[model samples]
Target: MLGAGAVLGLLAACSGGGSGAAPRPTSSGDGEIIVASGLDVTGSDGVRQQLIHAWNLTAEGRKHPARLLELPGGADEQRSQLLGALQSGSSQYDVVNLDGTWIPEFAEAGLITPLDPQVKADPDVIPSVAATARWKGHTYALPFNSDVGLLYYRPDYLKAAGFDPDSYPAAGMKWSGLQTMIRQLDTVHAEGALPGYQRGWTSQLAAYEGLTVNTIEAFASAGVHLTDPDGHYTADPAQLKTGLDELRDRAGSEYTLRGALSSYEAQSLSDFTAGRTAFLRHWPYAYRLLPQSLGAGQWAVAPLPGDAVLGGQDLAVSAASPRAAYALELAKFLTDPKSESCLLQAGFAATRDSAYRTPPPACPYVSPPAGSSPSASPSASSGETSTMPRDGQNRPLYASGTLRTALTSAVQRPRTPYYGAFTQALQSVVHGWLADPDPPDTDQVARRLDTALRRALAGR
Candidate 1:
């Protein structure tokens, strides 16, 4: 696995460069509230903290200056701690930055307060992202930063394999057609046609949220969802079965990353950016790290053959917050138009449509001049990331406008209050056959998944 530390300087440059120092912690004085998230604020998560510092210097009116409350880095740990606090109706924290998928879970439990009149969806915000901020018709959170999965491929390998770099992103192809492409590419990779290219494609398949994310995307492309808009379980066994078979096949490609069974986005990206794989399925953040790792034009992002799964975070006010009104103001400060621009410049895919209207000044990736160090001491603040590196000067359609369009067409993961349970059930069902040599019994697997989802949603 690539140590995340190896890429901090690159991530820093993508955000228009940052000082290596973590922001000195501020005292939580009378008028200041705390923004608690699973971010280090001084390390990989530095970008957001710097933004907070910038916001503090100008804060006035109902908005109180905010401080950072460091939380455990593990996503689950943060969720657990926040839930415990909310369940106890404590207001030690005011604003909570949550994974987009958690909005339903937190809001339904009354753990997070809705934005209400303080903030609401706007025409400038991406519709899909805006939708994630609302639950039961209330705007429960504000989209802070956003993400969608993308297909990163090497044109050199594709051209060597006799595939046209021109005829891609191949967004028109469904997963079935993508499977054929993968097989052909797999054959080419095994022949050593592209030096150091050891795999056809690599994606997140570990037994964690990433697996569920990939599963939902597969099901969406297959035209089945775990539930309908009303939140009822409505998975189609036949489609799900077919989708599982495809995942099994993608996982079986011989050239697939050898470390795949244990890999997540970081490992997968390290392989691709390191020139070990022909393709990688990862979020936009990879763009910021690639330029530092690869030579110019070495890699590019394209729309996945299927609907990309949306990934990102949102901000919600804690219901128990004594400073709910001011916290709401703080949320606005962090997500407002100006802040959104700062996020984009820093490499976070901002949620507002306006941010994308004018392309960000920096390309997602910029190779620093030769001999420039690839790292800097990053503040532990937060990393709001984006994809698409400027090749020192230009961005192709795939890296810029095309991606914003894809976000409009992207598929969201299931919007259920029991998202945690649903994701676990999904991980179990899919990973069971991911490494199996023999073809899976699709019917049996589908039955198991359906039951798992049912039990999960039913609180089993």
Candidate 2:
């Protein structure tokens, strides 16, 4: 029930810090927690705008507050900007917020400090965020707001396809099952009673982080291996082909529609909410906005298919910061339920397990009826009917916690120093996959991706 404005007010209060003498070049500096965040602030959905407001509200309650520097827009741009600022001779940023996936790159590059000491030392932190904060053998960042890919469904069209409103997928869990639904929905659309049946699924397939996340989830769900346990790219031709084939098939299927890949955040939401798409795969942050964005009775969330590859932001002190202990304290506090709730209330998903269990009133996405029970089962939920009984989207995985784990283990997309190149390669393939079925050379695409993954892993 917390509006965006209220959350912004809260962030502003939480970021109060005295502007004393700026610190020197060394990590050991004077008293100041110069926190720099790269959250979008100017846009309507800007997280930083809300964070600044929330920080302002929490400032009165904090024993010690930090000065927040709102990094400018552009995820990739902010990375370079913050890095330059932090590495500058007179850098003042004590705690740096980083993209969760980039933690490995940053940690290995020594751009961020190891968090093992803080993890070992801090007891009040959330377990999930704590676990992700550490990279390699040590912790590198404290996960701030966690996001996961969730499957969105419309109960209306799905039921029209003769999908069991209750046991949507109890009979089969294969992508083939969803394919049947999409094909039927397409038929129904042609009949004109339903809007021309579009693909049942929508996702960010453009060459961006959302594309990476969506493609990886499909690969993982299909049981593909892009890497080994030691984080090596598996060049196994069969495995690589299998992954690419599944991605291509999903793209070809009737239900999986090509969304506005260029701008995932705004465009995909528009497509799904406008009823142009039947199902959407996106992060949880969309849940709060979708109701308003899509209108009532238009949208609802089910547990993401197969599982989700959870992604999020992390808070870590720069290895170069002198206020390591204080920064860690602030990290621990911000992740605490009270502070996390403020962010959640404002529309961010909390990374803490505790926040998941006992969400503050502000967070609308936290209470999915499954509560915090880790082993919650989606189909096993007591016979509670969906609000829209006609929609045939996947059965709500509201309580199913195992589905999330299944997704995380399926694939860890090829990580590399030139992630930009690897992602570009993926963009090429995704475009080919979505084009009219010419049966593009799957083998060639696989080889190209395999080579790219290998090069990235090898740091070439």
Candidate 3:
């Protein structure tokens, strides 16, 4: 199978723009920064409109005056449009948003230029946010909306488990650990104290981005790094075995809390917000809907369990553009703390340190109900709550800040060219393993995986 990066790069190379020719846009323009962004505004058109409004306001007074245009259509269509934009020598759009994982592919294809030092030197921008834009030691796209998966829990349920609300493992916590906790919670829920209480954990596990990202987190925490230190796939059999075994066990276990294996099916997020799950593994965007879905105080949020990998997107400028500087300036503005907050307010998590550190009033909680004015701060302001693995209710019974610290220290998924292929192959193997009660010959599995990795790495 073709590795994700190679697939993209190959597409880029074959797209007729490999020689750095800028696509000629049917509509030519100067002075305005056209942004090709992908924020689906179909259902919540009002919210989508609000985001555009907020962005327009924040982008005003910037060094360059920008005209942000929403790029319509699906991802494949969008990708094609972006390529067409770059190849046609058209300056229709200066900035474009990319999935966080797509940064490498975009950069490798030379579709975007790296950020200039002048923008990095700006005091208004956060370095952490700026750093996310960098590709190959150069900044390409500013991190616009930043999101990391977190564990959502009910404090009431954890209290029933006899475990202190605090003291949940921050980093290095394993999915196996969650399995144990869920079993305990199920036992308590069956005791009839918590009637509506279901399984312990819920997640989107239908072979999509969420599944791949979650699996990476588990493997990373299990000490099975996806890519070698040199940023390439490794043939570490023991590491792979341990990681696969843990995943298979978790996947096969029927007692996984509701939040553990809930298929997104049709309306997973809607279902999640409806409070059908006890614990959820999801991105920060879900924060906006909790109040409406689970009711206030019923749901709580914390950083993802040990070694949870970060899943989000980044922004990049087209390298072949005539106005590279202008494109980057627009990119910088889009990822600016103020801009990030706007995106966050619009329901995405801002990747900037400032936005994350000095969260808007809605930081770590639901925003005011839909169509309501945004809050300046969280309503229930408590002291720095423990971020460690919490018992249940999002309350921090553990030491303050310990959870986030642990999570940050935990290993992240492999940032490699072959990440997609590796993950798909692993998923197949792991799924089969989970389905079979009698453990198949793991040796055969390993051989197949090893062969698959070698083939993917070789660009077959």
Candidate 4:
């Protein structure tokens, strides 16, 4: 993955060359519409692939077959590839699956076309998630799925530390209360009650977008918004200092797993699953993946302490596509209400309100085995048997209650045409402070960060 500074430089160069008008649409000889996206985290032949297969069976789909071309790498790599392809007209992507943070950049650059007003006004779309599809007051995409950080913990570990697992209120937990639990767990570890217990918690703190995300969550929890809704820099040195203090406490050596300093999502998850930490801060997808490793009663998930960050991808029609109308139809079909419900059952966080509140009809693509109950063990696509508990509706037991609440209240990262530059500057400064053995005074670091952000937002 590209480091923050390198990504910033690339974005600066791209923005310096002003964005021209979109290319005129032309008819294509071939009938295929290409959809470019990051790897489906649900594993090979995931729900996303299955959805495309379902679309192919429709009359409209049969005429214009939609093909998914997955970009291989982390989020930053995928962003770079999309930017290069769209800007240079090198690849003919009819539809693009974009991360929420990239919407403003893509929209303002004229790389994507605006969608109909109905997409923005759709009552079934979650309000917070729908907001991500718009840039400068115009809807440029439709949300395919939503994501939010959640706290996953080993109930067995909590019980070993002399805490009542049933009485623990993870949903309403605060930072102070979490610290208290960490102290107790530390003591228990010294007594050899918990083997391989390195620390209280683990999270993604590597010097990439993960570092930017972790920093934003800490700032949000401290009641700080670094940038205004218009994408202007808003924080002063004092506000930055306050937020930095909270982050320092959370990442302190005595409380956090040491590996977190260089850990990304995969590493942190591996550490947690290997019993290196009692608590883990991860995305909603972890709920499905964990069942493959941990048994039913071994773990549970709840909203993260304080604010969680919103993460997901939205589907946009390429402005230069020859088949723009058909691309739009395919995007809508993949994000419709039934599709959203199937996504929820397959472990991706569904973006529609109805997907959580109403009992859905049978998913059109997959069916349960004969004589199987509604709450069957297998997921909608993956053939493996899932140990994760489900409710009567066949949704994850915590889906309607715990997961829905988190998505409703999750905070978004800064929205800007220069988000690549913004996140790069953030990760550079924050990671430097966190990695230093003897860091500088909080106020000094805050001023440094404030200066960096101001220049970044100005397209410097």
Candidate 5:
């Protein structure tokens, strides 16, 4: 079972028509299992490639070696490529790495096959993460890695502003408290106490899926759910107004960096690392990369205020694959407890609880010799080793505590079969309003959004 608010919204019109015909089985059994996935953010020779290589050395893999096919472009572009390939039956993708939101869409369209029942009953998977693998009472994918938004802050800046960094809340604080700290940091910046300080915080607010995610976080914080659990348009003018007000306040010009208007993950991370903002709203991966730029004790991380969105990819066997059996085994091997521990060490939010609680043995896949520099290590990202402080148990110091707390309570974006349409409608309306110098009244915006959403959900 998933935590409260962990499950995605219900059914909607399916996106991209499928052939509805079963893929022809292949007679040749010697071909490699090709895995199609989005860019490996872990840099070249990433942890994923390492794990796959490890599997290839196994007795089973010697007969059927797997090759990783990294897709180019952002999430949207990758989705289109996958859908087109799967629909046309042109590509030989035995396994596909899909964003959690795409589970309903792929499952409803029969692009991916249901996973084994044993995988569905695996209790080691996080409750919220396990829920993402299922849609309409069947499991279509297995949780690979999990994601949740986290607040990355410059503790050095807080100290310079006469605040005790040690006194900061570890459990989490409300948005109002964060605002007060931001104001103090601003005052200090004005006095030339902090260099390159432009504003309180920055986040991904571009007119893409990032904007949709940010908007949903604001709406959830205000207790405004735009859609019912069944994915029906259920928001009223008042509810929308409340949600919009919260978004506007948090993202107001006075509090946020102007560059955030066109920023995505890379841009936001750059801004934060450049010392342009004291606070940043980003995913868990940033935790590893940030240490590359900011030295030890210079910054810290905590759970984001209000609700954070759940993210991460799931591994699914392509329905058209002749090597479905091998693909299934690969998925299981990649998400097994040992692999998950390796992911955690590499800075991903592991889906298994054991990765956090249990002491990890050396990553069997890629182990560097003792006392090697980051550049000398195979797991290093962009030639930089992670300086993320770890506990005595070898887990990230924040992993079992702060990070786990956030994941347990994180919320999901609307879970509709037509998620592409739903996100497009939401981002278009929201970004338009945010971009306006003199936006219309909340009621007018609300009406426009509601109508647009209804049309999108209804597949009009």
Candidate 6:
């Protein structure tokens, strides 16, 4: 499914140089400040409710009480609906949540307004995460929780294969080193030494924006930047080939789970939760919902073998909203140190620096909202992937500096107005390479990507 990344395809990008740029419905939403967010499936609804509840207690909060406008889940549909609202000049939504990759397209289109530069810079957020809000010299959005890929592994499985479980997640490991580990675990599982573990490794590699992210991380880890120093579209074919080659290795039969072709972030987590996979590449939210059965010693969160692509959602004032001022204030409230701390402890990672440094509050997580329905994309909950996970919101996550460090070291996907098309092109070509009977001659594929990216930039 195309998403906020795909929304880039829905709009016309730059002609020459310059730019532009979920919620559930509530009865109280009418006439109140409306925040449209992709539902947090990891079940952070209580955090949302309490934040709004807390806001209403203040004098200003009562005057401009914020409520949710749940958008249809998944990137593509959410983007389409949001674009339709903004383009149609609807005043229905005051605050809008955004995927960082969609910043260029919306900014270029003038569909969202730039926010306060000071507030954008106020938080001690990870630099890369902070960068998503400031594009082309202006800050257009507020940095909410940031996502960088972490390698979640079954410590028991690794130890069974004669590997040190604790050594892996503390720092970045080489991709080649990970492959060695995967192969060892694959063999171990095959020999029935790890009975419940059915797969060696799994990740968000399906033909969607997630593939684009995974592919970009591969390239970025190898020092390939899709944009040049000036932030213009440029890619070295050889470098791209190197990255794609690594992806091909991971997609190999030995490394992939049985339903690997269909896996996204949620599915990967589900498999991991069921003890079907030994290693998982997912975001921080997974920790909140992780089964108690696995427990702390059984799993660990560490940096990906290479740097990962940054993710998570952001908040913006819709250019079409009538209450831009109110919306901005509401956004500030939600992303403020206190609210962000609440979010951090609740499962959705926080974008505020203070949230990470401070101790988590007691009982930060809340129970699932009454009558919460499952999304069409089963397991699709994270706003980073799709929405938050629906299954594991109450699960507790232990704090470590690993995730914070991952955010600092993570790479971002290409910053282009045509991110949707660029992502589609990447997903298509990479999927083709993975599906090929013969290993792809990635040099040829690189040339194709070069053409594809140029065309996307040209808005063709």
Q: Select the stronger candidate by TM-score from 4 and 6.
A: 4
Specify the highest-TM-score model's number: 4
Residue-pair clashes, model 3: 39
TM-score of each: 0.83, 0.76, 0.71, 0.91, 0.90, 0.83
Task: Answer with 2 or 6, whichever has the higher TM-score.
Answer: 6
- In the range 1-460, model 2's lDDT, one tens digit per residue, is 2366645544443343222232233444456577887653123434343443344345432433466676776666777787676567334777888776666666666777775543553444445445556655676776677666766777666777677655664432667776777777788887784674456777877666677777787778777756653456665656778767777676655456654445466777777777777777776656555654554545556565564666667887777677765666666556655655445434455554443344233322122233334532221111222121110111123312422333233334444434555556666656655553565587877776777666756666
| Candidate 5 lDDT by residue in tens digits, 1-460 | 1111211110010011111222233422568989899877777767777667666656667687899999999999999999999988754898899999999888888899886553546788898988888888888988888999889988888888888888763456888888999999999998888988999999999999889889999999999887654566677777888999999999989899988989999899999888889889999888767777887667789889888999999999888887877777777777877778778776789998888888775543223333443433434335554456666655577899988888889988877788899999989998989889999988899888888888887667
Give candidate 4's whole-model lDDT. Answer: 0.82
Which tens-of-lDDT digit does each residue in 1-460 have in candidate 3? 2234533332232111011223333222355566677744213332223333333333232334455556776444565677677767665666777765666656766777655554444443344334445656665666666555677676556666776555552345566676777778778777776676555566666654556666777676666775653346775667667776656555555644433443652345654555444567766555544544455445666666566665455767766555555555445544555555434444554454454345333222222333244532232212221122222222222212432333334344555545455556666665555445586676667676667766665446
Taking the tens digit of each residue's C-alpha lDDT, what string does model 4 give over 243-275? 999999999898999979899999999999998
Per-residue lDDT of model 6, residues 321-359, tens digit only: 767766676777677666666566566767767666765
TM-score of candidate 2 relative to the true fold: 0.76
Candidate 5 residue spans exceeding 4 A from truth:
1-28, 116-118, 364-383
Query: By TM-score, how accurate is candidate 3?
Result: 0.71
Arranged by lDDT with the best first, the candidates are 4, 5, 6, 1, 2, 3
The clash count of every prediction, one per candidate, is: 18, 38, 39, 0, 1, 27
The TM-score of candidate 4 is 0.91
lDDT of each: 0.68, 0.57, 0.52, 0.82, 0.79, 0.69
Model 4: which residue pairs collide? none
- Over 4 Å off in model 3, which ranges? 1-32, 40-93, 117-132, 160-177, 193-198, 257-262, 265-276, 345-347, 358-411, 418-420, 432-439
Model 6, poorest ten-residue lDDT window?
12-21
Off by over 4 Å in 6: 1-30, 117-120, 229-231, 360-398
Cα shift from native, residue 112, model 2 (Å): 1.1
Best by lDDT: 4
